[model samples]
Target: MVRSNDNITSIENIQQAFRGVDYICSKQIATTLYLAFRLNKPILVEGPAGVGKTDLAKKTASFLNLPLIRLQCYEGLDESKSLYEWKYGKQLLYTQILKDKLNDIVREKNNLAESLEAIHQYDDIFFSPRFLEPRPLLSALQQRKGSVLLIDEIDKSDDEFEAFLLEILSDFQISIPEIGTIAAKSTPYVFLTSNNTRELSDALKRRCLHLFIPFPDAQLERDIINIRVPDLGDSLRFQLVSFIQQIRKLDIKKLPSISETIDWARVLLLLHADCLNMEIVRSTLNVFLKFEDDIAVVNDRLYELTQQATKEGHA
Candidate 1:
């Protein structure tokens, strides 16, 4: 049986539920989820990479105790890949096993025309749900108890694929020519995330509630670090977050994300480092930055970065 959001009756409850799962979110996120649930609409979450776009869906599933069905989008994604495909191997086996029955059904029909007509009657038999392979999109629709469907990185998919999602997003159903349209047994809570690689169609955007998540502020990042690494001393956490926030201000290919901050904190804990210093930061720079160029750029200003972080930590 599909569970309704009768339990999550208010925005405050949404915030509490997400907090219970250790996903610290702003009131905007809570309000977005609340409205999406109340309206039965999908949410389009747009933000830079690693701002917790994917984590939001995972945590929501945990909070609701529902199964999460994730479709990781990429270039050249299409309906057959995302929606459904015929189980050709199973269908072939079925056809072989049913050969005798087929012969018996056509025995009375002596003419070729009659035999062809008899086979046409059973054409749809092979195309039934039994022979259909459900992909993430179809699987979500088939769930009796509903699910949380996360379409991660929708922007990477081709324009054709984006258009293909229109019917499913607007109607909570998919049309299979062989089997006709399949509607959701229980509408899943849908979330589509984008890193803004490209602009999404206004048509697709129109069907969803838009939510933009930017980088966390210093205090919020500190709170997140505390939640993620509780054993870390407050002073170190402040310095690390402050350093990251400052680095974000510099022109870089990729800024350190909230997850990376937590990871750096864990690294410091393992090394038994109580504070951010030039030596420690230099060695652990790779923990946060992905590219060597980004590391070198930050390294050029390591002294200045360290001094500022230390000053902010003291203040």
Candidate 2:
């Protein structure tokens, strides 16, 4: 773990820390994380699915030794779900428990006007933080030690929700009608990921530092496989990564991600396969491709892919 008082102040240090955790990242990613930490700005990490956008946040938290608070966004997500909501059941029980006290206070009141005034004095009691169930957004703010706040897949959320995030992202605070404003005790390192399901608003984009994480190049992919699946032989590792790289070049519904590459590597390790071959590749094609159509397409080209991998292995 990278200590808080250590060398994380530099981009090179950031890269070294991530590498310590076996997460091989490019210089651009290291720089983005460095700036996000130094400037205390939210990072808008846009990339294809399974390219390690979400993993970046998790690894940063582990490297920094901070808690990771994740809010998984989806269609129809709203402020109440992502932010805070009143604990209605708890509030109701409290209200029931306070009924006797309320009656006793009202008994001393002269008339309806006095009784109303008495009730108004305690109006804010129900809306306090005790009864406020803090969701991911609000919970991040309340962390005195700070945290890594990851809003995963923000593009899946509604436009209204995106607009709501603008204030929090910019100011590190949230506004509640009951409570005028709730500022962060300690500003958290924030990261928002998008799969590009829809275009985010310019206002939202303007407030964040943007980064695009594309698929890793062949060498980087191989390094990642080596680190993650160390039990595999060097020969098999090269052939497997090369095969996946070739698969990504095809026109498919979903390309195999870095995660899938690691998965395939592990599967091969478990099967005690030393190198890529037609029979083994055919049997494990499902490990790389997801859709049935993608499987059929790769099946048609499997022999050729294996031949190419074999030629590269001997070269």
Candidate 3:
């Protein structure tokens, strides 16, 4: 949504914005981003992990020529970490200078309290270098040029952190007790991603333009894999993605997402496996399935799928 000379200013521009990648299908998503851009609303992308949620934001940033300011969320993230905090060490050094200038110890001690109070009033003077410790959210807001602020995995954060972001979401302003409120220099086009590990409050969802991304269908997945890894052959690409789709059907703790499917294909291509075989499949199985138990269960299913293929004369 961040304005630039790029062609992404309107929905019609999305095709050129993402020129090479053919997998971006959802007309709804392009419309959502376009509408959000026009309306100045933050776009919320929710879906299962690895379904191109985060990639969309990155691609948008690249297309718009704006810096991608990513705030990767986790459990127990606090305001000081997300917004800004004073540099206490620098403040301490200033106090030490005042200590050295005193000729009378008692008078210096009396003035110490007053000096500290005065110093506290101008706490911004002792701030850490803006480059050294700027939080992602603050950095985006402070930039004179519009930026793409990607808040990745919002569901991983706790309620307190979500509450903390409300003011920023509503006003694009972050209030630091030490430095007062820092408003956005250029209205950043915000994109928030969630894996839906848990349901976020309606209050948070209501503040932004919302969209749900799901696993791409067969044709879309094939297009995506081909675009991302062109070295892969047609037969091998179809086999690899079909195998992944079959695996997703079985009950498992972690199924390979679209990103993992691409990785699996890349691994196959790197190993010079032009076709699907037991040796190649077994070696690359670990790349797709993270859990040992999930791998063990899939081994049997893999044999079954291959056997079915052999019977159907498709192997």
Candidate 4:
């Protein structure tokens, strides 16, 4: 079961809030979220992909008992897609119904346009609620229940999309030309994550508290592996994490992350292996190394490690 926001007080509590995460990351991410909640500011997180940047927002929402609203950013994203748009088909149907009620052809056409215009005036009704279709930001605003709105991969978006968010964050309000403005009953706790594929505008960064998440060091990686794969014996856990860390240090195109450490350990546990040996490491190498090129690279390195271990054992 998850704890509520009322139970959270300090940065450490957020460590417990997101279980199975590294202590350094847990603290940094939790502090970012805590500060956001305390000051009503958005928290912007920048990191490499698969580094738990997106997961931090999810844990925060779950811990706080808030609704999670996720906006996946991509190339070609625009205001209408991010905010809202009218369902023209429904509007056309409403216009046709009004046309049927009139006798004169000219009057019928004029009445249809007036009727369509009146639909916009109904503000409270008539409009097909197409503009009412809630994107992440708007959904968070409309939520009477509290929400955590996560704008993911903001760097993938164009500058125009970033510009649009500035007003929404400051006011917690969105303006619809047909329906006027809508404001939140309570502002959502906002978290924005980026893979840093592109540089974000300074204007956007200034609106939020910021955090940069890097990959974990060896000790933290071991701790994370232990938590994620608890059944592994202490000796094996240390050995495998250390070995993976050593392997990651070599000249490889891709390095295993804290997550990959956990995955490798879990794979070992499933195999019921009690120790790290040449056969076990080679058999389960897939967890730590993903691509065929990475595997080939590690396999050659593993042979070297095996020879070193054999030498040490003989001595």
Candidate 5:
């Protein structure tokens, strides 16, 4: 049997490893991840929401048996939050506790000039490792056994924050003003997901490998539905996926993604639904479609959708 560490040996190995963890992935995803591992490059995954971009990093960590550290990005994110910050409260408490010791050192000096110089040595202790608070990025780099560092939703962050990541993405190191530079103990497997809310910078894009995960096609969606909602009967599963595929075709504010399909399937299973019917689809329409306008649009075509999906299920 091949060890888990050998997952990077080939793309197939990565696929098998992900399968072992119950994460079904396509050849493109497996290949990109394999290349990222071999080249030590971060993967930039761009896609619409709920297409498994975040889950990929989590499952990668699960299969690899590495700690997963995630930094959720949003507007106004900065280095102090994602990377590191000093523990000011702890430093203040230390100052109070060491007041006598600090005073004794200052008094021990013969003159004012010498005392001030002597206190500088103790000043270094306040800014040392003990006072440093490691955030997700720094915590990932500090892992002795390596980790899966997921920078989730990079597009949600500001341009400056994205630029801030370039140094770590390129060299796996971060520079601190007082502490100087700190390199990774072991290079982490990095994944940055984007929802395409905004266009990313070209310079930021250059440092990493890129991948896009669109909504799965019929066959792939079927396979995913099978894996994720296994207890759903074949007839119901077929009808459910077919209905979702049809729904994606319509003009709507939000199309049902894979996650919604899984949720609908599980809901059907709980409700003891064996197959698709007009009443069931009508009642459960809200499970997948979020907008009232979208639901109304689907309601207009309710008969058409139920007939089509049921025909496919029967076939």
Candidate 6:
């Protein structure tokens, strides 16, 4: 644990705290999170695209009252972008200032060798902390009061970047060639999320506590919608969740995610829909089902879906 606020003594405490922050956490989620806190391990969260993988890290930071430092990963992501980069403009500015003082030091040197040696003394000044711009990885490590580091979409990044993160995740430190190795002031709680586009390296997985967030079931998703949109009538909320659940089982191109379900719930609430009638759901199909083909496929079965959802909702 990095600070006094790490008082997450048990799984229930994590659930309670997260619920207080408007996040509904499952037992599995709470347990893994509790273990991560106690063992000081980075969690590698993998799942389908919008199952709240990234939001878990955000909410943890919120409930723990820690600063959230995010690094959105992409293809070709490297250490300089994710860890640190030299403030080249600032360094160049200082180089101009150093040029002004150049004559003072070299003028005192008798010969070329002596002047070269004298100039070398100021070489390190530009590479020092004053000229270094810390990125998310370095910034998280430097947070003395602790922080949450979210590396979103790790699968989108290159394997080299994944390998590069191994050292920082395992040891809570990073090596900078210009500055040597810099250890963390207070270890940050780290969350690395992947949409599972590709298989991750074993080395990277070994260093982290793996967690998979699958699509929520009807009851869980209904609860999520209820909390997120409290003003939504209970019957309509259930109907919408039931509709989403039914569609998820269909052989569609993209199953509607929990977020899309929530979006649909809000849409229904705004439309003042009192029930899951075919007309309203038909018009709002685009809210959750993204692909045209997906929408068309669901549209073909809209009558049966709406009937089942309405029947199940009232049941």
Residue lDDT tens for model 2, 1-315 = 112435567888888889998899799999988887877789999988898999999998898888999999999988889999999999999989999999998999999999999999998999998899999999999888888999999999999999999899999889999888999888888999999989999999999999999999988998898888988999898898889889999999999999999999999999999989999999998987999999999999989998898777666
TM-score of each: 0.96, 0.96, 0.84, 0.83, 0.97, 0.97
Off by over 4 Å in 2: 1-6
Task: Tell me the RMSD of model 2 versus the true structure.
Answer: 2.1
Model 3, residue 102: C-alpha shift (Å): 8.7
The C-alpha RMSD of each candidate to the native structure, in angstroms, is 1.4, 2.1, 3.9, 4.6, 2.2, 1.2
The residue-by-residue lDDT of candidate 3 on 117-177, one tens digit each, is 6555654555534413568888889778889999999999999899888888888988765
- Alpha carbon deviation, residue 158, candidate 3 (Å): 1.7
Q: Which candidate's lDDT is highest?
A: 1
After superposing candidate 4, which stretches have Cα over 4 Å from the reference?
A: 1-5, 20-25, 97-131, 303-315
Q: CA shift at 291, candidate 1, in angstroms?
A: 2.2
Tens-digit lDDT string for candidate 5 (1-315): 112356579888888888778788899999999889888889999988899999999999988899999999999989889999999999999999999999999987899899989998778989998999999999999998889999999999999998889999999999999999999999999999998889999987999899999999888888888888888899898898899999999999998888998899998999999999999888888999999999999999999999999999889
| Better-scoring candidate (lDDT), 1 or 3 | 1
Give the C-alpha lDDT of model 4: 0.75
Which segments of model 6 are wrong by more than 4 Å? none
User: For candidate 2, what is the TM-score?
Assistant: 0.96
**For model 4, what is the error of residue 102's alpha carbon versus the real structure, in angstroms, after optimal superposition?**
6.6
TM-score of 6: 0.97
Q: How many backbone collisions does model 6 have?
A: 0
Using TM-score as the yardstick, the better of models 2 and 5 is 5
